[model samples]
Every structure is written in structure tokens, then in C-alpha cells.
Target chain A: MVHFLKHNYQDKDYFFLWDVESGSLHNMDSVAFLCAKKRYDKTLSPNEEIEYKKISSKDKDEINAFFNQMEESGSLNSPPRVTYFKKNPDIVKALCLNICHDCNMRCAYCFAKDGSYNTAKEYMTFEVAKKAVDFLIENSGERKNLEIDFFGGEPLLNLDVIKKTVEYAKKAAAARGKVFHFTTTTNCALLDKETADYLNREMVNIVLSLDGRKATHERVRKCLDKTVKYEDLLKKAVYIKEIRGDKSYYVRGTFTVKNLDFSKDIIALNDAGFDQISIEPVVLEESSPLAIRKEHIDEINKEYERFANIYLDRRKTSKWFNFFHFMVDLDFGPCVNKRLTGCGAGTEYLSVSPSGEIYPCHQFVGMEDFIIGDVFIGIKRPEIRKKFSEICVLTKEKCQNCFAKYYCGGGCIANAHKFGEGMDAIYELSCHMTKKRLELSLAIAGIEKLYSINA
Target chain B: HIVTLFKSSLDKNHKTGCGECQSQSCKIHKKM
Candidate 1:
């Protein structure tokens, strides 16, 4: 019941104990770490047991009393009971509009299957885009700000539609006493001065795709014309960074087995003047050549530590940018709704395909089974909505036992449905990576806090 | 034996009422 994970930074002599149930973090000595592990009824490793034996009886009793006090304070074993927002359905707060399911590039690991989502290549019409915006406004309930993400094979492919959609959402929201926050994810293949200017002025955030280094990026992401150069794309992205000024943007990359040394890619993006960077591992079936497999988890885990060190190194400079996964603000994390139920996919958020059909999220856009409703009907399938609404750490049997349960919110439902047993099941591979990243995040936060305190 | 670095609970925080947080990282992930 004392759910906690003992973690330490690489080559650091100190250890940290994270009380998962309560989100309480502590800096502890090695003996206390091993002692807490044993007292929690967890079996210690041979080396840990050896160290455990070295603890004096008095010290052991003191640590036990401390843990007992924490337990008595309801911070150790008690997991909060979460009530699903089913009785009163959660108001939709965000939507990912698949503006155009057609891409100019051929990326091997693209989940959208070259932006078509394995469907007929299409673009969302102005009418459909307008309806999607209206759907968001109608369902947003008391929420003032609604989020609409311009997504696609490459959102900029339907640049005109994106602009029109933004215009429509802005006008519609203002009239209805609601505000819309716009975001777009692009390959930067079709980005130009005019489009960048338009996006900079309209979008609150933009995600630019660059798969790390040139070799790694080119290995998977290729232009249809074959004449486009990575340098050209990089130039345009850098231009956006400059012109966008203070508005948020990040260069996101996907690393496959072909690039296990993905930390170098984060460095590459940083070196290229991109401060806010995120390089994520590709999610592919193991049979695929580019897939990150069981064999590669160890290497990837080590890469995470390597990236953590580099992240800390950058923290000492003005060049530091927020790494997506490593941005762990312990004092101010996600709200209770998000912490318990994860990203509100079906309930509080939905995805709109080019034709206006609604799915649970962007990852489920083309999958027919996931289509809960269309923009016209507005969530017709209450049963499907109920299923999504029920998803949470408490509902997931595996997550209930996981130390990282609250942090990950039972992992991605899309990944669970695709790779695991079902929506309630956890994706083991992603779970492994999530735990590693969480560990590193805590270590980074602890190190920074200690450093600041010392200074 | 224990030096508490940071400790806070979801229930104790007043910001749990709304989704709006200045941290764009949360929004970016929510949108994703």
C-alpha cells in the first residue's frame, strides 16, 4: 500500500524517494532508501539487502517511525477515490481538426499512413471546418477557452482552410462569449513566409516536425519531389522561430530503431537554435524495421539519462528550453481531472476528420470503430462516451498497482487499444518509457531545487 | 533521514477548477 519508487540520478551518490500515492518527494540517504524499500514489504536486491544489513537498529527504528508518521498522516497508502464525470458529462474543451489528410512528405513511421489515415486523400472544406468550430462552441459548456489544433497529413497543406477555420473560430467564439486557442502541427515542408506570418499572428502554439539529425530525419521523412533539402526546411523553421517571437513553438522529432542515440537529435535541434525541442521514440509494430523493440529499451533508457544530463547542463545557461516530457512542475501539475483520467479524449476532447466525422482523438480519426459521432449530430453514441468517461487510474487494474499511475494517468488509451489487450490495458513498452522519463523528470527537478537552494 | 524537497496534493491546490494554466506545455500535450 505504501506505493513509492526509489530513484537516483546517474553517477550521483544521493537517492530520492517518491511517494507515488501522495506526490511527495524526498531526498534520502542510501540506508534510508534501502530501509524504506524493505519496510514497504518490497524485496530488496542482493546489494540493497547487504546495505540494508549495515543500518543500525536505532536508525532503522527512526526511519520506520518517520514512515509510520507519513502513513498515519494519510500520505502513504491512501489512493484517492475518483468519481468519473459520467453523470454530468464533461464539456468538450478541445478538438483536433484534421484539416487535410494529405501530406507532401513520405514518413515511414507516420501513424496517419502518409497523412491519408489509409483513407481517400481529402481536405476539410470550409463548410465542414466551420461546422467543427461550431461543434466546439456548442459543447464547451461553461469553459471560456476552447482549444482547436490544426492537424493533418500536414496541416499547412490545407493552409487556406486553416486560415479560414481560425477566422471562423475567432469570430464565432467572440460572439458566443467563448475564446478559442489555436495550435498547428506541421512538417515545415510547405511553410513559407506568408503562411508563417499568418500562423504566427493566429496560432497560440505550433509544433514543427524535424526528426533530429539530417541522416535520421532523411532516413524516414522524405519529400515526394525528392529535390527538397533538410537545410531548406530547417531555414524555414528557424524563420518561424524568429518571427513568432514570444509565442510558443517546439521542434518535435521522431526517433526509430535507426536512431537509438536520439539524445544527439535533441542536441542537434538545440544546436540548430531550437530551444523548445522534443524528440520522441517512434511507436511502430515490432515487425517493422524502424520499430522500437524490447531489445532496444535498455539503450533507450540509458539515452534518457544521457538526455537528462544534457538538459541539466543547458539549465545553467540562457539556452535552456522546455523538453516536453521533462517539464515536470511538481508544485503545479495538471488539474485533478487530468491527473486522474489522462487527456480527456472522448469526453472533454474529440477529433474531427476531413469529412467532419468525430473520433475519440487524432490517433483514432480514420478508425471507423472509434467514430462516436459527427459534427452534425454531436456525440450520438452515449455508450461509447461512457466507455471513455470511465477510463482512469482507478478503473485500470494494472494502473492501480503502478507507481507511475497518477503521473501517466493509465497511459495512452490509443496505444492501449492498439498494442495492449484493450482500452483498460496498459501498453508495456510505452509504460516502460513513461516510468523512465518520470524518474528522470523527478531527478532533474530535485537537482535543480538543490542547486537553487545551495546557490 | 528525509529532506522533503517538494510536497503538494491535487485536492489541496486551488487551480484544479479550470484547465487554463500559463504553462503552454500542458496545453500542448492536451492538444496532442
Candidate 2:
């Protein structure tokens, strides 16, 4: 499939085309864009006053020849092949330790059932956390650098486990000649100076949760404590920003149906002194009131477009910040295997529950059917690992015909299974948003490239 | 006119040699 988009940046018209299998980008002029679009859709007809309708027969043939040349160079219409599946034993590289299953806030759109994961509220003991580290090192297989994310209903609730886990992991990993890269996700509601200092000194990356503007954040992420308002949370987050200067972090927010104009939320984050930001669309059941429905896709797409323009304007100034979804690494994207298989949730990465029970990823923590094994015993179900190992674009029938298949890697399996029919089916809403984000990201990248060349 | 902006190394014929490599982690893959 030919994946291309027409965009207007600062009154400059441009077209961005993507080579699906090769993951390459080409910027096309209007003539080439029209010709390529027509090629992709044979019955496409231009309006009477349009430029394509006024093209000479000779010029049309020349455009066709150019397309043929591009096709011959394997830069257009080249489909991906189904390669051999590599299923190595004991190659897991990352673990998300859900240290606490209890949260301080009652976010209406929370997927973790208000941080309890649909179970009783609990905290991971130091022993379980220590075993999790040992489990990671024992099963890491020749991997030198390992990743451990202190995750949960708010990992700071179980502060002792996090501190002890980090200290133990460092000592154990040093003895085993393995390096640990630590990260954590927090709501910043319980962030104090002492913990903030400790996190700054220990963690490599921290994700601070704030839902953008005061009203928008207050609408969904309701703190249980009446006294702790949005301003209070923002103060704590800003303190982290002050202490953790230049360190990698993001102020992550979620937008529901209530806040379709989520661009304002992102801008609020940038204005709040947070540079790296990611405001994601909330995934909820259709029955839920706050869930983003099929009809909301268009408005969300427009919001993204508006945000892209604002992002471009900010790029020219000193106040610019990075938006995670809009950022793409052209120099070296993910490897072909990774691009095909996606995040490696079940195989390469696993989530450890408070009790040391292991699931595929954080999303699958409480589901009994998805329980592969515990950290102490290691992955017991090879069949589940095999299932995720075979999860690639080629294996998923719905993804085979999609233009954005390679970019998203068939999307999150948990969402597909929860929202769609099964793991093989695509979540249509998420897929639509993904395509829009990819298009805008490519357009921004191309526009910047042109600017640099002209300058 | 058409300008090729960036072509990734993960083309159809690109070889990762994942099977022979001792370390399974790629820097870009780890970001995901």
C-alpha cells in the first residue's frame, strides 16, 4: 500500500510519501503527489479546475515514467516478506516491577481499576522485589544492560521497596557484570523533597503524570485528598524538574472524550516548564462515558493537526519542547525485527506483580488467563511466549493490508484483545489515531529537512 | 520533483545478525 499525506505548513503546500517495507520517506511535489495518488487509486479523478486535470498528455507520461523509476529502485510498492521467527530461550531484557497496587488518586479513566488492578490493595515486599531482580539477571542470557521500571498504582506509596530494590539490584547486577537502568512512573501526589532527591540520584528516567490544564486534569484525575489540588501536584512536579535538571523525563497526560481539545493540555505542560511531553488518547470501554468513540477520531485528528502547527511555531523559538508521538528518529529507527514484532511485551519484557507473579506486561498484570509464571520460577508457559513471538505484521491478517503496519507493529496487543475481537484484530480507533500521528510526524520531519537544506 | 529525505537501515534485505550476536538488545529497540 502507498502511504502518503498532503499537508500545509505555514502556507507552504507539500506531500509526504512513505515506503512501507523499507521505512523510507520521500517528499513529493504536487504533480508527483497527484500522479502517485492516482496510481495508488486507479479510479481517482481530479476536479476540473485542479492542476492534475490541466496536465498535458506528455507530462502525464513523464510522471508515470518517474513513478516507474521509483518503483524499479525498490522505493515504492515494495511489500514486506515474512521472515523466520527467532525464538531464543531466556533472552528477556526488561522488567516493570509493580511495587504497589494501591493508588492515592481516583482517576475516572484509569485502566488499572484505580490502581488496585481489580484486586486487593497491596505493596510488594522487599524480598519479592529482590527476587525480581535476581529473576531478571538469571534469565537475562548474555545481556549486559538490563532495564527495571519501578511501576504501579504509584510506586512512591511503597517507597521502601523501590529504594531497597534499586540498592539490591545494583549490588547483585554488579556482581553478575550486568548494569541496571532504572525508571519510575508517578502521579507526583506524594512526592516529597527527600524522595525526589533520592529518585533524582537513582532513576535514569521518570514519568510524571499530570493531565494538562487544571480543569481538564481535575475532570478525570481526581485526587482522593480534598486538600491536594492540581496546583499542589504541579508544584511537586516542578520541584522534580528543578532537582532533575537535564535528565530524561516526560510529563505524561491522558485525554478523554471530555477533553478532545487536548492540544491545550500539551501546551499547558510546555508552559509549565516541562519540556518532554506525551498527551495520549485514553483507551476505555465503549460503555464508559469518558471513552473516546469512533466519531471522536476526526476531532482528535484535527487537534493533532492544530498541535503540529503550534509545534512548528514553537520550533523556531527558544521555548520549543519535544512531543513523544511527533518525534521520529530517521537516522536509525528500530531494527527490522523490532519494527515487525513491536514492543516485545510477552517475550522480551514482563511485569512483576506485588506478589512476584509475572505477566506479559503491565496491562496484563491482573488477568489470570495471561499469567505466564512468577519471577521466582521464571516463565513457565512457553506457549504464551511462542504466541507473542509470532506477533508480527505478517501474522496479523488485519495488519497485512495496512500502510502504517510497520510503524505501529500491529499496535498494543492488550488493546487489541480488550477492545477488538482478539489479539489478531486491530483496534480501529487507535489505528486511525496512529496513522494521523505518523502522517503529521513525517510532515514535520520533512518540513524541517527542507528548511535546513534551504538555510 | 521528489526529494528522498531519509531511508532507514531496516530495508527488506537488511541483516541484524540477532541470532549470532551475544547481546539481544538494540539501542533503538530498547526505546520501545
Candidate 3:
């Protein structure tokens, strides 16, 4: 019954380790385990909440046998009583600013009313951009690896700001004896020779947001001239890749349901010398312009799946950085299949918009309600961390109980809150997709590893 | 032997499901 001795471990502290059965389950704190050992002879019920007392050998064997069975099937014996993520510090990978809130092309599904179509010229001031930099410097001083991401109304609209921020960050990083990972998500509308040179020189990652082929891209991203920007975007895409000389530099892609059919586009990117692509389903929000149905998500997932297979098979992209890292559980070789499968949202790499408002990520920007803190004040004044802590404490319910919990951890906080589902909601379909995505990614990696001449 | 190919089996399955939800604009349904 006490095969793994918890006698030395503190009575109340939980242990997150593999058990004797080679299964991952949080078998209570030291006290509880000892208590279970004491009740060694009692009739055990895995679900029943009870205390301990010294018992017989037969009962001990029975209890141990039952626990092993549960572990074999990938289920948790009980809730997690300890949390490690709460104690560890986070490294700031990228801090994206809402530099240009006024894009030239009005995307059809944009949720913000103050968008290109509505003509809200809400550009970030140079001072606010400074604050974003300050936020990075101040909040992430402890870490050696850091990144500064430029976001948009078409961030190129505020090219001066992008240039200034990167330049400043480089100097500041040098001053502090740190480094920077400069990146951006742009519409490729402003991908000229000048910008391409600056990007390649600084090794800046240009994330082009084009859905797919000309027809597909034109369907949504439209300019004021009512012209489909597809042809222009494709032209720019070709130039950006050719000039960058490195496939990783030309990260042009799109977000939308229509883009699930990106095989042709994937082929194009592969052939054009620009590879390392990133793709995501157009995130559906309540305030979005279109009435997206479930069918769209299904189709998008399918499309993304097809695209993912092609890109991954060719080694054009690795899910480890962008999609899979967020999607899967590292140890599991798949996403933690539980309901709350996700990383430390507020706790890990945080987000700060142009207005000095702190959010969890760029995805959660613009939704004013999601703002957890403001720059003028600081993290101490905000309840964002507090709320996140409360959410993190809910591990045992949805996550610990489900088989996929460890692989997933917990999902995106925004998605959980958006669905009006508490963090404890039983396995979200995201759990399923996350697992599905990673399993495929690893499979691809294995196949590549097997046949690669380098290997 | 039952190990499923994520791209072919699971991912395609999820995409078809998401496509159905894509038309809804996420007001009533925002996520998978």
C-alpha cells in the first residue's frame, strides 16, 4: 500500500509524479497517502471521500490493485492539492502593441467597430509605445530571452513606431545586456523593398495575414476601392519570401473559415522559397461581423488539418513553437486531453496593448473587459493575477479528473470565460483538437526523422 | 494498431465540426 513512501514528504503538500504503474496521477498529499496506508485493511472506494486508519494486508493489496487499474485506463485517483505554476516565474516571449488600429483593408469578420470599415483612426502614440517597451523591460528584466511583437491597424501604418520600438529595444537590450525576438503579424499590404530590407536586417519575422489563394483572400479582406487585395498581397508575398533569403522570415498566412482549403496556398508557399508558415482558424467572437456557424469551425478545422499535414510533412513549420506548444502536453506526446487543457495564461507570457492596458495575449486585446491591469498603476493594483490564481486552483475538477488533463493542463482562459464555462468545465473540444494536433505533429516528426538523409 | 493519424482522422473531423459553427459568428457560439 505504501510502495512509494510519502513519510518524508509534508503531510499536506501534493506530489505530481508518475506512480509505480507508470501512470500520471496526483495521489493526494503526503498526509493523505499516509492516511490511506493507515487504513490499509479497510474496503477502499476510489470515489468515496474518507479518512485513514491502520488496516490489514488483504485490503491493502485490493486498494493498490484498484489504483493501478485506474492508472492503466488514464484516470486520476483524486484532485491535485498542490500547484507548481503558481510559484514559477514567466519569460516574456513577445509583447505586441496595437500600433495601428486603422487598417486600410476592412476584413469582413472584424469584431471591433472602430476598425478599417468604421474609420476609427485609433493609433498608438509614441509615448504609449514607449510604455509598452517599458512594460517589457520592467516586467521581464529577470529573463534573458525576450521578444517585442508589433501588432496593427496594419502596423506598417505606424511603421515609424515599429522601427523606433525595434531600434530602441535593441539598444535597451544591449544596455541591460539582454536580447530580443522581434516579430509582427501584418496584412502584407505594406511589404515593400524598404520594409523587407529592414525586416531581414533585423531578422524580424513578417507574419502576413492572407487567408489563402486570391479568390479566398479577396472574399474577406477588401480595400476602400472595393478592390480585392489578393493579387497585391500575392505579389508582396512573393517579394517578401524571395528577398528574405530565409523561409522562416516570410511567415505569411491567413485566418478565416474559407482558408481551411490551403493546400494550393501551402504548395505555393513551399515552392516560392518562403516556408515556415503559421495558420489559425479565424477566432469567432460575439461582436464579429459575420454570423459564423458551427459548420464554419468544422470546415476550418478540416482545412487547417489538411494544411497542417502538408506543411508539417514538408518540415515547413514545427508545431512546437506556435500551435502545438499551446495545444499539447509536452510529456504526453499529445495535448492533455482534459477539459481545461492549456498553459498559464495570465501567469505565463502576458500581453500589453498600446493603451498601457495589460491583457493575457494579443488575441484577448480590444475586449476591454479582459484587461487585467494598466501601465500607470502596475500589476500590484490589479486583480488579474488574483482571478488567474483562483482559476488555476481549479485543477482537480475538470483537469485532474479527466484523462487528458496532464497533457492539456488547462485551456485558454479567454475561451473558458467566453463560453460562460468556469475553468472547471469538463473536457472542452479544444482538448480533443489539441491532442489530435500534437499526435499528428509528432507522427510527422517521427516520419521525417526516419527518412531524413541528415538523420 | 488503433493509433489514429491526427491529420487524417481527428483534425479533419474537427474541421468539419468547426465549419458548421463558422456560420454562426460566435455570438451564440464563440468557440470549439
Candidate 4:
């Protein structure tokens, strides 16, 4: 019933995003969710607002005139009446601190390096880290409950810095009558009794990546001697669960198509012990597109279907994923943010490097051109703000026309900036996949509820 | 020409290892 209702989005009229300046794209829906009392306010200049109201209230001819005037002025602020999703930012949402550009593991698909920082070697000094904490705590207003996530090459490696910052954050949030939670998604290469105990005491929710079993995991992730990094990962996963005793600490893996034929690893992780599972495809860069040929797509889709059947039917306490789990879990609706729901780049959240340089996300860290701001001045500077405004064009052309505009939110600014695709390119192959995934989720939910299969 | 420019900009703006969101897919996956 829970899964069915959560995935059931037929009732939601609009999508909402909150505190976009600090909100991470991942976990955004949960973070930005608000009481329906707040309504969306379209951002428009006074003249544009007047024209929109006039067109909305006047006859068709007047509406066309106003629209033409808007087009001439390039002031397309008011979108025609659409489904409304109320977004009330009454409390603090989520904070993604790119604490450092450092990581312990060297995942092959890492894009966070230029001539700069792709390695898990560098870090932010205590000074910069402390300053960032002070800034947040000092100015934090209406931030009722803040879920702080540590992001980096490996946030665990910089444990002291985060522990220090968290001390201040907890006190600040408490002083403001707010709550605090800590979470991290790591490769699980640095988990030991000491580190695990510290994390458990901090009440940190962990997501350890184990892309299936040994062979598949080793294909991309490796250590000094090309050793499979599975044993320690599983050991730590089980150990963390036992220590924390919190079923919410998610220990799962991502599955790329190369391992479509493998379910042993999924079983292995479950055996190692993790209850929550997040099985997603290897969403490669647009340039690469996950190496998915047409046949591969069809084959993987079928394989995922088979895999999902096992996952759904299994009576085990631990969760296991075949492939279709991610696709079958989301509620497809317009994002909820009125100012910017599409891309959290430049506007809401910015990914900062160890040196205080900023990028859109961890994926886009330290690329010089995409540096929206710096730690010295802050992200609200005119130059950075200008950079942000320039990139907020997802609603430009193709994205506005597509029905999935609300559903897909015109993806990232960096990837689709080319391909003759502004934020509004016609539904790409990926968008098609998202829509298909939504339908699958709806079907699974409908089945689970109507047939009482999950009961 | 466009691909070169795009790649150059990506290299300039986006460090690798960041999620290859490329565009809408990243936010789309998260949003939905």
C-alpha cells in the first residue's frame, strides 16, 4: 500500500522544488515536499505580469496580442495555465556539502577530474570547512530540519572535518529548534570498526555502492592488485547495520547492463545483509549513453523484467534487486519548484571543490568554465549570479513544448547544452526511457495493490 | 564543430567523476 500510494501520482497536479540554491538533485522530491497551503508564484516583470493577466482575462485576440508582445520583448515569464503544485519553503530542506575534492577510491567512471582533481587525494583544510559551517549556521533561517549529506572523492577520508562541522551544525540547528541528520554514499573502501562506530554514533545513514557481485564490481571498481573489493564492502555493510541497528541505513548497489545476466551479486549483497535496495542502470554520459545498443536495451529490459519478478516474489527479509527496481519506484509528475525545478545547477545548489571552487554537482567538479562561484566571495556574487542566470534556460524552447517538461525537467545544463537541444529539446531517448519507467512503476503498483500480491 | 565545442566546454566546466547527468537525465531521475 505504501509503495502503491507513493508511486501513484495521478493526484499530484504540480511538481515543486525548494531552496534550490542548496538542494541536491537527488532526494529533492522528499526534501522539497511542502504543505499544499502554499501556491506557486510565477516570476514575471510588472509589464509582463500585466500583459499575462490581461491576456488571461481578455478575449483570444487580446491574448494573442499580449503573447506576441511578450515574444517581441523576449519576456516569456508566465506559462499558460497548467497544473499547479504548491511549494511552501517553511523549513530547511537538505544540504549537500562537497566537503572536499578528495576520494579514497578511483572508480573508473569518475568525471570529477580535469587537469585538476579526479583523484581521491586532495582535501579542504579545516579553516575552509569551519568557515562554511559558520556561514550556514549563522544565516540559517526557517531551516527547521536539515539533512546534511557529505559528498566528495570519499567523505569518509575527511572524517575529522565533517565531524567538526557536524558538531557546530547540530548545535546551530538545535539552537534554532531544528533537527539534523547526516548521510553519505561511499564506495565503502574505508569502513573499519573505528570508522563504522563513529558513523553509527553520528547517526549517519550510509549508502555503500556494490554494483552487483565480484566479477561485475571488479570490472570497474578495483584496488592495488585488481582485487575484488566485495568482501570488505559486504563485511562493512553487515557490520554497519549491526552496529547502527537501523534498518534505514541503505546498503545497495547499482547494476549496469554488463551484469544483466548476473543476479548472484544481488543475492550476495542481500546475504551480506542490507534491507533497502537501489538498483539503477549505469547512466553513462550522454556522449557514451551507457553503451546501450538497441538490442542491448531490449535484452536488458527483458532481463530487468525477469530480475524484478524475483525481487517482488522473494519472501526474504533482505531486499535484492535484479534491474527494474529503480524504474518501478518513482512518481512521474512535474517537479514541485516554481523558480527552478528542472536543473538545480547555478540556482539552488552548487558543488564545491576542496579549494572552494564550485561546479554544478560532484560529476561536474572543478571544471574551470563551469565554476559558478568561489568560497572566498560566495555563490551570491553578481558574476556567479550572472553565470547562474545564463544557465537557467531549460525552459527555453524544446523543453517547454515537450509533455515531459514537467516530468523530465530538461535534464542538466552541461550535457544537453549542445545537440541542438536547449533545456527544451524534444523527448530524447532518455526521456522515453523515463516515461516507460513511470508506466512500469504504475503497473507494478496497480498490480501489487489490486491483486494484493505484496500482502 | 558543435561536438568539439560541447566537449571542450564539458571539460572546462565539468570535472569528471561527477555524475554524468549530461542534462535532464540527472535531475529527471531524481525528480521523478
Candidate 3 displacement at residue A86 in angstroms? 1.8
Ranking by TM-score: 2, 1, 4, 3
lDDT of each: 0.81, 0.82, 0.51, 0.48
Cα miss at A103, model 2 (Å)?
Answer: 1.0
Q: On a 0 to 1 DockQ scale, where is model 1?
A: 0.31
- Give one clash count per candidate, in the order shown: 0, 0, 55, 36
Ranking by DockQ: 2, 1, 4, 3
List the TM-score for candidate 3's chain B.
0.20
Q: What is the DockQ of candidate 4?
A: 0.03
Q: Which consecutive 10 residues in model 3 chain A have the weakest lDDT in total?
A: A1-10
For residue A398, model 4's alpha carbon misses the true position, in angstroms, by: 5.0
TM-score of chain B of 4: 0.20
Top DockQ: which candidate number? Answer: 2
Q: Model 2: per-residue lDDT, tens digit, A1-455? A: 57877889888898878877767788978888877777775655557237667777897899789778777877777666444544443578789999999999999989999899998998999999998999889888877778999988989999988888899999999999888989999999889898899999999898999989999999888888889989999999989988888887889999999999999999998899988999999999999999999999999999999999999888888878899999876656656666665767887788999999998889998999999899778778978877877676667777777777767866998998999768867788999999899999888988888889889
Model 1 chain A weakest 10-residue run by lDDT: A80-89
Give the lDDT of residue A347 in candidate 4.
42
Stretches off by above 4 angstroms in model 3 are A1-84, A87-94, A111-120, A225-228, A250-265, A271-273, A285-344, A389-396, A401-409, A420-429, A449-455, B1-32
lDDT of 4 by residue, A119-226 (tens): 445777767765555544433455444566787767877888888877877886777776677777777777878887777877556777776677777776665434
